[model samples]
Target: MPIRYFIKQWLMPPGLLLLLLLGAWWLRKRRPRLALACFVAGLGGFWLMSLPLVVEQVARQLETEPPLSVQAWSGLAGRADAIVVLGAGRERGDLAWGGQDQPTGTALERMRFAAQLAKASGLPVLTSGGLHYGTPPSEARLMADRLRDDFGVVVKWQEEGSRTTWENAQMSAAVLQPLGIRRVVVVTQAWHMQRSRWSFEQAGFEVVPGPVGFLGQDHGRPFAGLLPDNRAIWQSGQLLNEVAGLVGYRLFY
Candidate 1:
């Protein structure tokens, strides 16, 4: 726990902020010089982080055309292993009802993709997630229900009690092992596939990467995409976090 806390702090933006604040205070005797120095340093740090570039490069490396058209997944209707969907975000639900009715975010995207995959492959789906906050049904349960009601796809649930990637791998593997599910078609955002694949493989699952929602290319207006957008920063943060996690998993897990 201590190590985890240490790593978390070390990886966040606030840690850099604190360093800048302290350096600025130390140079307070020379106010103008200090102000200029701090401004330059802040910009330097942001540039050094280079999140947008990192995200773009990673995305470029992993990007693929949408796999198995609707008809293809529908064709696989009975022979493939489970379509495993990973969780990413959560939504607020009615507190009085114990989160049972809260809308979920990325879980929905995962399910949508899983449904397509299930239709193409004719395989039952496996949804993996746990409640990290509030009182809602576990993400896996909510996803399973969505699969049944919305797509008519049968699903198996792996309610991972993990709040991080490593835990997700460990918990999901445990659930799949009992059912002899060794090979899985993993569905998640393209940006996340590298880390997800690594973690699952480390956990002894044979993963067939089925990435979705790519961020690198713009098919219609190519010029507009050349300029970086706000999402670039977010993507960069995700990439750094995944790299850090991979290192941490090796060192500690």
Candidate 2:
């Protein structure tokens, strides 16, 4: 795995929280007061992550782009030259589809939305992603396959060597810009769209943000989302990662 992946896993929540709890256990007798502080921080962090309301609030601040209206779907061609679907990730393999790698739920969400936009506007589609752990059948190819087989929408281009959002924009630019395609509609999660749009714009494209899978809306859970849910932890992690990516891209890219 990449060193950056390790750094992120250790520095970000859940992993970081785990470390704090471990520290608390190690220091329980040696430094009682410090250990209690660590324990409280670690447990409190997990509790906040497990609350849906916390996810909703953080997501509200991150998901700046609004969903496109249904009526506007068919008119995408007038606003852009093509649709670009940024891959989230891919499932390694499963026996259900004869052990072939499949797009993850996040990637499928992007493909589904891209298919709708493609069918409505008749614009060409480009899928951008890289290999799965440096292996064959890149994410771009997986999404392209699903789009064709499941959605009946063909992908005109597959830039299949991007591992980061910045790479997605830069690699897609290398493919589309040469063909005189400069304007594109970028399809990605709502919280992810801001960084994606910034990267694509930096790569010299006229971007139309096509965001989907918003998480900021009401959860309608018991106690108004005060209740803890395991899924909320994952949602909170995703939103936090987006915030890190937004800052990282501005710093490094």
Candidate 1, residue 143: Cα displacement in angstroms equals: 1.8
Error of 1 at 140 (Å): 1.3
Candidate models: Cα lDDT each: 0.68, 0.95
Candidate 2 wrong stretches, greater than 4 Å = none
Candidate 1 structure quality by residue, lDDT tens digits, 2-59: 6866877654644555567667777777786976687677666555444455456656
Model 2: per-residue lDDT, tens digit, 150-250?
A: 99998999999899999999999999999999999999999999999999999999999999999899968889999999999999999998998899899
Can you give the lDDT of residue 190 in candidate 1?
74
What is the TM-score (0 to 1) of candidate 2?
0.98
Top TM-score prediction, candidate number: 2
List the pairs of residues colliding in candidate 1: 73-119, 73-120, 73-121, 74-119, 74-120, 76-121, 76-122, 77-121, 77-122, 93-102
Model 1's TM-score against the true structure: 0.75
Error of 2 at 194 (Å): 0.7
